[model samples]
Target: MDVSYLLILLLVGAFATYFSGDKLASKVALVFALASLGMSVYILNLFNAGQNIDFLSAWITQPKVAFALKGDGLSLAMVLLTSALIPIIIYSSFGNEYKNAKSFYALILFMAFAMTGTFLAADGLLYYIFWELALIPIYFITLIWGNGDAEDRKKAVVKFFIYTFAGSLFMLVAFIYMYQRSKSFLIEDLYAMRLTVKEQTWIFGAFFLAYAIKIPLIPFHTWQAKVYQKAPAVGTMLLSGIMLKMGLYSVIRWQLPIGRFAAIEHKNIFIGLGIAGVIYGSIVALRQNDLKKLLAYSSLAHVGLIAAGAYTLTLDGLRGAVLQMIAHGFVVVGLFLIADIIYRRYQTRTIGEMGGIRQQAPKFTSLFMILVLASVALPSTFNFVGEFTVLFSLSQINMGYAILGGTTIILGAYYMLKMFQQVMLGETNKKAFADVTFNEGFSLVAIVAVLFFFGLYPKPIVDLITPSIEHILTFINRTN
Candidate 1:
């Protein structure tokens, strides 16, 4: 039940799939991802049985950082989320053809490997190492395999690489500063340190700079839409689905507690910025004609609220952020997949060119409609639960913030329905509009099934992460 088992399975599977040869790569990758999900379910069961799963070994003794990975309720939830979704991501790609199928699927597994590490790392240096490790595979994945013009994709990819890497440097400086005081990179040791207000402010600034750029609060979000547009469906899914959560997770686990008073002091400022992103992202999304770019902006809007909820630091806000993060991950994957589906069938992503897809494909229309509704936070969907909780929490802080955040409901509905009306419900097009195939339909159905399942009864995940949320709140509330 050690958490390392999950990492081992993923890393080994990456290599195995690579060597399995192109003929067998897709099947091998699918089997590996499914096997990993099966193991993860077992781990979740053990965790629910009130057992701890941890692995530790001496690593970099001079620096006093152990190869430490810990699994508590929070980390386990994220790891579970990553594990559960990888199979779906892999399966969704079954209809597509990648030039270098072996290396492509292998990168997907590698990205999951690094993300799992980031979630489980109990030490700051170790966490940062894993954090940086993640950006590598994704860089290559997008740069080489991305769509659009090669020069345009290269520019977009490089800007993202430089932006995020530069942000990490600030985080490393903060870690080294913390290291100077504690002589260790263990999270607990860093959390236990007593720093002057001046020092806390500096650390907070550095950490916030790093995480904001990733969670991509307003000014820092410049790279998102472009990068998302260029990357292939698989690449886009990896970025939106699980990679973005790394920043939000770090915000709750590392940023808030590490800079408690600073976070509290400037919280409203950051929260305002988050709400602004919600508005800005939504408004911009309204103007986008390209299907993927529209979803990209919509994602920015959705995560904007999630980020605001995290900054609120209320129980409702934090819990809602967690729930919404999971919900949004599933919903966005389905949305992007639908976009790809359209592009594959119609050979165009321009919404203006798409019409009456429902006439040709009722199932695709139904599934697409559900995901769009979920994105807009319609009632009876999992997104509604998270959006309600987050807005309620923000309202408690400032009604103005709630009102601003609430615009997502309106604007999201406007753009999503508008997109749908134009694309799925209109005059029948002369061009053929094919329905989703078995694999594609299965992927979308699986996603919608989870959304409704948790949408109706989220108590399992809600109960599972409650203790961890309490643990997080304790550090944030500490006066020391």
Candidate 2:
């Protein structure tokens, strides 16, 4: 099957949604997302049938650049994630009425195109194009539809745009330097280049700086909380659920092999930074009253652990990191949706303003509880599997690092339970709040089912990712 057909379908969906009226626009978007999901599953089937689905060819003659799209286990996993989440996001917007539903849906479909592109593109220049392209729709989505003070939204959007683009510049420089050295813009060629330790370290630093900022680790994370708090729920879902993974994915795809020695040599620094971000984010989350801000900081903490796992360079660590990336994406999106539910009912995100929701919305409470448990890495949850694997792998590297890194679990529980208790378990205030509507319930239930399903049996994902992880490790070991 020609995978380019999938891209064509997405573009067609974008145009169709753009022309449809408000009443029908959402339906068009939903259909598009569902079709995209079907296409993704078909791609998986093709892969299972032992066909290499990625398409690559010459693009620009003068620069000798190629347009390459490859789907290894990692890229396929991300593609599946993007495909799955878009429908949920589109569905979650059911209660939200936009002035121009056509434009709104079109933007969302366009964003989907960019995300799929980011995951599939294998050439450095092509990857960079998708990298920047992915940000455009989100910037507009947030700027046009975000809540809070207009100035606040503008400030947040500008900050997010500038921060991410600035990081991309470093990535661009790294890619150009690699192309200059190797005389090719192909990803595989860059990976194949022989470089001195110093060169590797410099390139690694450049790449790491870009990805870290995008992942927004520690000091670089200042923009995330504000942005999440200000952006609309759909925008928040897209950014936290899908876009952040670009950074983590890039780290695995671009930085590891290119900077294998740097990764090993500076493993301690990355690990230390990861630990700090995890602990710091957790502590900061404990103090946050705004629901969105709390979740934002929680995301920072979770990504930190994943980052540390990536730096470990151990098989289990890398596996756990990739799994955690997937798990976190789902869990965070669910959590944010829960936040959106509360905001819809009570019109406030402040924990102090929420109480006794369990009495009115047991279903919401139950789903929120599961997501919280997952966030805290409870047993039988996917988060537990990922966190345990990462910790176990960290132990292989250093007992002390494992011990320090493991505190995220404890800190995670403190903030998560605190948030849950405040929002769901308290005495009902005099105000009446509506229980979740069917559409809302469907979205939550779907996400909960996925979380539990994956949690109980993660072997499929683990099995799928193992070969790719092994392939990446082989490169690292060979280069070292």
Candidate 3:
């Protein structure tokens, strides 16, 4: 029942998939992904039962680091999201044939392993290691299996690698500084340790640079759309779905608690930066010609709002941010998979080339429409619950913040609905469009069911995450 078992399962799965031969790699990887999902659920149940599930052991004594994994409502919720979506992401790719399938599938599990570790690690050094580890698999996945011109893909992927990697170095520096002051790499020690205003500002700025680049807020977002367009569907799903959440989660887990002075001192500026990303991303998304690139911008807009909510530093804001992270993860995966399905049939990513699919593929249209509605935060959908709370949290801070943040809804609906209209409606095209295959439809349905189930009755999730959110808020309020 140790939390480390989850990491072990995925690591073993990656190696097994790599050696399983290309013919069996996909199926083997799927089985492993599902098993990991099952294990995470079991751990969640045990967590609720108040059983001891966290793991820690001595590692680097000089640095005071431990091979540590901790599970709380917050970390476990993110872990469950990662474990759950990975199976669907792996399944969604069954239709396409990739060269070196073993390596491709192996990297998927490897990436999942790194992401899960990132969520669960409690020691600062351990967390940073896992954070960086998550990047490697995705880097190879995009470079090897990506969709566009080889040169362009390389440039985009490399730029992403450099941006994220460089940003993380700042985080590392901050962590080292914290360790110097606190004399331990444990997150709790770092959080409890005191720092002068000067120190807090430097640490906060370093962590902000790291997370913002990964979150890719407005100015730092140049690397995002290109990378999404170039990467394969699965890579895009991992990036948009689970990878970005790492940055947001760290904002709550590491940055706010460790650097509360700076977080509080510059709250408005940080919140404004997030809202700006929302408006900027929404406007840019309006004009995107490529489907994946459009969705990428849409993700930026949504994440910007989530970031804004977290910076509000209210219990409601942090809670809503977690809720939206889970909600956005599933919805974005479904959206990109839809884009990939259309590409499979039409062999193009351009919106101008697509039309009248509503006439030919009712099932696909229905599912796509549902995903579009969810993206815009329609009532009774999961996104609504999260978005409403986030905006409300912003309102408590300032009406202007809420108003600007709320524009995501108006602008999101305009762009997403317009994308849907252009892509799914209008005159019948000469090219024949087939309905989603059982595999594709089944995946979409699974995603839709989660959104609706949680949207209508979100109490279970709200309950599970509240205590942890409160715990983090305590540290955040310490600066006051």
Candidate 4:
């Protein structure tokens, strides 16, 4: 199957849905999403069979840059994720009454196109293009349809754009530096280029800054909470569920390999910062009264642990980080969706204002409880498997770091259970609350089923990624 052909299909679908009447726009979008998923699955099979799908040509003769799109295990995983989640997000929005469904579905499809391109682009410049392209539709989606005061929503959107673009510029600089050194823009060529310790350090710093900001690590994470609070729940789901993984994925795909020596030299610093983020994010979340704000902070804490795992540069560490990335994406999306459901029912996000929800919404309560367990790393949940692997890998480097990082589990449970109890267990409020609708229940059930399925059988993913990670580690070791 031609990857470019699939891309064109998605592009056409977006425009078709855009012009289609609002009454039929959603059905059109759903069809396109399913088609994209089918294409992604086909790509995955081809990738697993070790076939390379090239979509572009050799461009520049002097700098050795070519337009290319290829799917490896990592790219395939991301494509599958994007394809799977877009439809779910669309389905989750079925109950929403939008002013212009045509435009909404179109924007969603365009975003999907850009995200798929980001994962598959084989050239640094092309990847950067897709990376920025992915953000444009989202900006509009949030600005036009987001909650809260319109002025505040605009402010949040601008802040999000500035924060992300600032990081992206630094990443572009790193790419330019590599192109200069390797005389090629192909990622494979960049991986083969060698740099002095000083050069690697500087380049690594720039790349790390970009990814860290996207992951919204501490000190750079101020934009996240406000964005989550202001954006529509669908927008939040895309940002937390699929967009953040791009940052984490880049850390593994480019930064560590390109700056191998520097990464090793500064391992302690990364570990220390990650541990601080783990504690700080959790502490801050403990203080948040809004459910969306709390989940935003919780996401920060979880990604911090993923960053720590990446720095470990061991097989176990990388594997754990990869698994954790997928696990956290699913868990966070489910949690935010639940938050949306609660808000729809109670017309508020404040935990202080919610009570006796479980008495009225048994299905919502059950699903929310399961998601909460996953978030807190309870046994039998996917999060526990990922967290345990990461903690064990951290312990291999430093016992104290492991212990400190592990404290997030206890703090996580404290906040999660407290939030759950407040919303579900207390006396009924004066206002009447509706039970979970079938649509809402189906969405939550799908997410919970995935969480349990992956938790019990993560080996397939682990196996898929092992070869690529092994290849990367080998290159690093050889260079060292």
lDDT of 1 by residue, 378-425 (tens): 888999999999999999999999999999999999999999999988
| Candidate 4 least-lDDT 10 residues | 471-480
Which residue pairs of candidate 3 clash?
none
* C-alpha TM-score for every candidate: 0.99, 0.98, 0.99, 0.97
Model 3 TM-score (2 dp): 0.99
Question: Per TM-score, what order, best first?
Answer: 3, 1, 2, 4
Error (Å) of candidate 2 at residue 64 is 1.1
Clashes of each: 0, 0, 0, 0
Q: How does model 1 fare in lDDT?
A: 0.91
Task: In candidate 2, list every pair of residues with a backbone clash.
Answer: none
Better of 1 and 4 by lDDT: 1
lDDT, candidate 4, 1-480, per-residue tens: 757766787889999999998998988998999899998888777777877766778877766668788776767777777888888888888878788889988999999899888878889988898899989989999999999999999999999999899989998998888887777888888888878899989889998888888887888888899998998999999999989888888888888888989999999999888888899999999999999999999999999998888888988788788888888988998999999988887889999999997888787788999999999988888888889999999999999989998988999999999999998989997777787777777788888987898888888787777887887788666644
Off by over 4 Å in 2: none
Model 3, range 288-393, lDDT digits (tens) per residue? 9899999999999999999999999999999999999999999999999999999999999999999999999999999999999999999999999999999999
Query: What TM-score does candidate 2 reach?
Result: 0.98
